[model samples]
Target: MSLKGKRVIVVGGTSGIGLSTAKAFLEEGAQVVIASRSSAKLSEAKQTLGGNVETYELDFRSEENAASLFKKVGEFDHLVITAGEGAMGDFRELPVDQAQTAFNSKFWGQYMTVKAALPYLNKEGSISLTSGVYGKRPAKGASTLAAINSALEGLMRGLAVDLAPIRVNVVSPGIVDTPVYAGMPEEHRKSMFNAIASQLPVGRVAQPEDIAEAYVYLAKNGFTTGTVILIEGGALLS
Candidate 1:
């Protein structure tokens, strides 16, 4: 894709799919600006990505800060939001308080971000959001995630219309082996992924790089809007 000299912003770009996508954009000669809640991760990511990519500290919770950052950065070509943590639990017993807090971070944060950055976004640019297969096919204990992801997909379609010429799209990845599962024991996490992989039609889960390709397509393709590029490893098929 010819993204030469295009300015791109990656929210939650410190790690995982976001980080991988930023690298891909830079390789395509896009000027990449990365944002995340953690300053330490941002610093680490910068050192790893070299001097080409810019880093910004942004907590999605703070709309004022996000607005200020976008205003300062001026009009950029594309905005890719990969913020939010994965939340999975029984729907009935999911702690209302914590789930609500997580929801704000995951769902509402994206909405707030788009609202803040809309004024500065170039008409030719696009806003790419991250959703997942869980929205369509929830697993056991994935009730919360399924609900939130479903809502997120809805949010993307709504933003597509609201934003008009500025494209809005979502990439739905299926269980990429990212740091999001760091809370689990290493051995257990690996085994879990292995087991899940065995069940998938593709015979593997996604890598960060695999899902990153979808973002590149959405950002570079001008005709694609209100689209969900599912990068799952054929999990839904099985």
Candidate 2:
């Protein structure tokens, strides 16, 4: 339950939900390790995290990279993967290569990390993967994202059974205010958030920290596994 002194590794931890999850784990007195593909972003995240955690450069798409990460980390108590690039566009217009890349990066990336970490992961440990609300309540142009998310949740369920005693779960967040949207023009981004907020019962989009808490809960709760904790501003309800 208590995370004090437990080791937690967060993949894709350089920004967005992953970074916030690292911060949250630190707050709970866990020993946190953050990994991502960008060294520069990892450096920035290390600084942002107050330089108290370990940083690893990991492109989970590479089996070697994933293997190297656990080798260097030795062993850890929890593995959280929040790194993924979603592909958006009408299914008809979406390029097959783009969809494949998205799947490789998000779905297979996490898969590879899990495979690499299993031997090094403590038997008491847990694994948390990221999904999205689109898997359940998809909209136009979200076909690829929906498929990827659904696959991840399915994987979680199977893994929980296969890796019994070592819990596996998912955090399926709705739209959150994170750097993933940094490329959007400021006005358009704000407008989009506002428009979505009006429909949600919560009256606002989620912050990365909001979703971060769910990850924390998953790590601390021993009885929960094979579950998808949706922190989506009630988007499915709306």
Candidate 3:
């Protein structure tokens, strides 16, 4: 269970929660490799994560790329995948392409990563994927995200069985303050965050560091598999 000297690959580890999770591993004395689609972000993350962290520029959207990435990574102790494209919009107005983006990125991307990493993963090592609170409880303009996230949770269950001792689980976190909201208008984003913060029992929405710890827990726990570790800010309960 000890993470010291373990090798971990964090897909989407270039920024946000993924980056924070990577930092967590480094601090635990694990050998970390971070992969994402952005070379620039990867470089920046490497600097922020310190020189001990290794990095790879990866496009997990392609199964072949995912496989190739693991081939290069060789063997590892754990895999934490938090990279995905967010698709949110009104269901009635959604285009097929728009909806498919979420499926391709979050769901299928994680699937391919697992498939590829299995051969390289150390027996008993863990894989922690990401889901969301909205998967079980949706709101306006989140139909696509909800469906994709639900699918991911289901995928983790199946993966847990198929992968056996390798162990597979998911972390479903509530809204976190991250760059994922950068696309929103500043005032609107602030107002939305404030509103969510006010409503949550914890009095604040999650931050990347808040969610990152969950990933570490999943990695360290040997008995847990095929489970969804929900870390939402009591949004579902509220």
Q: Pick the candidate with the highest lDDT.
A: 2
Record all residue pairs in model 1 with backbone atoms less than 3 Å apart, i.e. clashing. none
Model 3, range 1-238, lDDT digits (tens) per residue?
8999999999999989999999999888899999998899999999999999888989998989988888888988999999998788899998989888878898899888888888889997999999898898987899889998899999899888888888899999899998899889999998999999898899898899999999999999899999999988889878
What TM-score does candidate 1 get on C-alpha atoms?
0.97
Q: By how many angstroms RMSD does model 3 differ from the true structure?
A: 0.8
Q: CA RMSD for every model?
A: 1.0, 0.6, 0.8
**Would you list the C-alpha lDDT of every candidate in the order shown?**
0.89, 0.94, 0.91
Better of 1 and 3 by lDDT: 3
State candidate 3's TM-score. 0.98
Given candidate 3, what's the lDDT at residue 60?
A: 90
Order the candidate numbers by lDDT, best to worst.
2, 3, 1
For candidate 1, lDDT tens digit of each residue in 60-158? 877898898898788888999998876777878778877787788888888888889888888999999988898999998887778778898998999
lDDT of 2 by residue, 1-238 (tens): 9999999999988899999999999999999999998999999999999878999998899999899889999988999999989899999999999999999998999999999999999999899999999999998899999999999999999999999899999999999999999999999999999999999999999999999999999999999999999988889888
Which stretches in model 3 have alpha-carbon errors above 4 Å? none
lDDT score, candidate 1: 0.89
Task: After the best TM-score superposition of candidate 1, give how far the Cα of residue 47 lies from its true spot, in angstroms.
Answer: 1.1
Return the number of clashes found in candidate 3: 0
